[model samples]
Target: MSLTTEQITWLTKEQISWFTKKQTQTFTKEQISVFTKEQIQALIPQQITYFMETQIPYFNEKQIPWFTTEQIQALTIQQIQTFTKEQIHWLIYLQIQALTPTQISVFTSKQVLAIAEEQIPYFNKKQIKAFTPTQILTFTTKQISAFIEQQIKEFTPTQITYFNEKQIQTFTKTQIQALTKEQIKEFTPTQITYFNEKQIPWFTTEQIQALTIQQIQTFTKEQIHWLIYLQIQALTPTQISVFTSKQVLAIAEEQIPYFNKKQIKAFTPTQILTFTTKQISAFIEQQIKEFTPTQITYFNEKQIQTFTKTQIQALTKEQIKEFTPTQITYFNEKQIPWFTDWQIPYFNEKQIQAFTPTQIESFTEEQIKNSPQLLLRKEEIKSFNSKEINKYNLNNETLSSEIKNNSRKL
Candidate 1:
């Protein structure tokens, strides 16, 4: 016959130790609840395994920590599942470490949340992986940060998705750097937004490339400013296209050339306009050639003036055709001669007419000869001496008549 609750409560600690596993299995929840802490401590691992689910919750915090690691580990899954949040929190360090992956895997979200932050890191990788996303979400920021590198690697992308912004923000820079490319790619755009500026630059080049366009768009100007050289270079054209105008200005001058032609062309006109003169000068000839006419028109006077002869000469006719008259006058005398003979004709009459006298004189005779459609203002023609005008093959009478006729229309 089962012992009554009153009789069970009256048992001595020594008497509790004498009970067989068969006798332990017959104890009711009421009988278990009446046991003194001293009596509960006397139960062996074998007796503990036979405790019914209904009896396990009756163990008070004072009684719970008395469970030896062997007794804790030996508990049936049903008995383990019966642990109250308070009981889970009361478990000692050794008791937590004793849990098998199978036992850890069965923890309800509340049970996972009840784990003491100090004991979180004791879980092995297998135990870490065994947690469902629901359980993963229950981990406090302190508990999330307590994870070692090996434990962090065990988090699958699916499990990582459940981590709220606060949990993601608790990651150390070292932890951020330790993320594999695949793991880095899996962060949701919202999750990635929680990464602090200090952590942003620590991402490896491969990890940067692994970011989606949506993730790239989510970066703040502060985060964009901290991206290292290789990380900036790793951004794909699609990723580059999403950067805000403020973010574009955050790119360092030294990093500007690392952008490939397609990446350079990915900037919107507003973004293009934000490029500093130093950044514009960083563009290689190939990158210069990639700028759309609308993008070319967005360059400020300083930006236009900073272009090297090689970059200026590299601009396609379509790009040249879009230059404003103000932009044309911004080019220094040295830059004038770099324009190819073929490129000269694409300039509108207003553009050709806008060049300063020094700029007109800088043009080579071969350039004048090859560009039959090149338009020169009457004043620009007067800047050349007669011998030079003869050498340039200007038909003064015919040009004078045409100039007079053009002035009449104006």
Candidate 2:
């Protein structure tokens, strides 16, 4: 007779025990006669959970027939949970269509967690997202945190940069706050710059304040300069008002060397006047030292008149010391013509006597050559010595010929 649906719905422990005994070689024919194929077919729906849970060991030992995909789909949550790794894998592979959302959720949460923890790359994004919220929450804080940390740690520098900017805009405040200091340190300058520019509310005031002086000090010079520049704009009016003159001066002085003259001139009168006399003196000396000779000449005519004789003498000595010997000679030669009014001697006898006769002769020749009127009076002398030597050679040959003629007559 065909079994009723109610009969198929319930598989008792005694029935399972009877089936087990029947499968053994020691069982008698009466024991094996417990259920016909029709009865077993009716029993499948009811016994699926039982088969999945308790019957797997029996199936393995007795080499029982495999369940159809439809029968596997009928398995309960409890049944699916009890599956061994190999059974679950086979079920996933074979019964792919048989899984309901509920079954998939349960199976993934429990089974997939283990698989994912192994970091198998074959898992799809859809499969990863399929994890139930409850399953996700089931993970220990440390586990989830560690997994996130590992992902960040394993991220390439390029990936970290991309995520850092993206996370500032997209991640929840709590999520951003969850990152450890070491993780935060992975952010590149560009990433941090983006974060600061975006003004992420995720960074609590206290958290922002938590950056130590030493930590801020660790930033690159450019970064520090940028931060300080930003702070001038970012700080509230009250905070700005709190800045002491000394602080402002310190920043200005530190950056002044980098500023152009126009930038330097932008300082308020009071700010400009804040430079002590000693500082002003040092700055002047530095500027004077850097000026070229032409610039110095311009400055002497326009600016140096303001200085005392001692200062001018000091500047002159510096200029003289820096001049090349040839430059000094040229300067002296040019200035010597102007010395009569300055009461300087024109050319000392010792200086005049220092010139060699050859140099003097060359100098006199050059002066005459350079004179426009002297060129007309100068005569060119051709050398007659070549013609004389030729005539002498001819005479010697004729004399030698006469001597040979006389010897033959003899």
Candidate 3:
């Protein structure tokens, strides 16, 4: 029997579910809009398959979840855009997954944000790329965390820039690792500060290298500690120069040897002073040679003592000259033997005087031969073999003239 539009609105849900496809198709958009929410929800998937594009927008919020996945897939782009935010939010994960990329792209920002967390991974790359930056910002942290790697990677640099700090922190390490270098470079310093220690090390070498100086500066000490040697090696010299003293201290000792000469040289005196003894010991002879004069001067007594003999020998003549008398006195007696003949000449008179008699006696015969300006005290001079002193003419007037010339250079 044919029911009038008025009669249809009054029908029970069970009665509405019994309607044939031909019967449902006969309903007009105006007639559909007047139907009871319960009656609309009762329409079976088979019956709803006959819904005209004109009738699609009539589905109100309360009736939205009752639409089956097959019916949702049938929606055209124009029909999808017609749904209210409340209607969009009511869609189950299955129904959300049914949307074509073209249909998903047409959703308004409000509708896009209304999607549930469980529905987030249903969006394919093209669907994710279609979201505007404004829409991307509307996503809750829960929804952001639910995104799969592919969806996370699909975000354009401009879209990635709009993620709030909370949303940025919610990304899984795998999702973070999936981000393109362009997207990584787009993060602001404030957003960068939100990453936890576990997430920091997941960045690829290229992604780590892509970080801006400001962004690199935002990493907390805990986050800085998590960086791997490979990632540490990727940091540009300019990025290295901007690290705060506290952040510099957080660098892992194992990563110290990975720094290139340029990165090693970029360290400021304040930054150099922050290295632990263990980190100072970790530096290779090659890295030791790259130290700036100011950096060499800043090493604390404890740090100076940690250097290996080979590292000690790697110091340039200018670096050797930069050592304070107090720092020179801190070196181990064993380390005194590592000083080369040329390096010995760079020691100022005060540095020479700072050495203990044992340290002075530890020096090689070749070192004493080249250090014509070295002025040992009576007891310190007694510690060395008289034959070596005589061979080097250590007590001669040439020592006095060499000291005068060295004083002129200073």
What is the TM-score of each predicted model, taking all chains together? 0.65, 0.24, 0.64
Q: Which ten residues in a row have the lowest lDDT in candidate 2?
A: 375-384
lDDT of 1 by residue, 319-339 (tens): 999999778878888788788
Model 2 agreement with the true structure over 1-410: per-residue lDDT tens digits: 14343453355645643443224333232332343333344444555544435544333311122455666678788776766554544433345444565665686454654433333323333333445645544544333433442333343333344443333444444555654445455555455545442244455433334444333334333433343332433333233233334533444334323333333333343433354433333334333334344333222212222333233333433343343322222322223222222122222222223322222223334443443322221211012133653676534234334333544565
TM-score, cand. 2: 0.24
- RMSD in Å for model 2: 25.1
Ranked by TM-score from best down, the candidates are 1, 3, 2
Runs of candidate 1 with Cα error greater than 4 angstroms are 1-22, 25-49, 52-78, 81-102, 105-110, 252-262, 265-380, 383-410
Give the residue spans of candidate 2 off by over 4 A.
Answer: 1-52, 56-67, 89-92, 108-110, 116-129, 137-410
> Between candidates 1 and 3, which one is better according to lDDT?
1
Q: In model 3, which residue pairs have backbone atoms overlapping below 3 Å?
A: none
lDDT of 1 at 165: 84
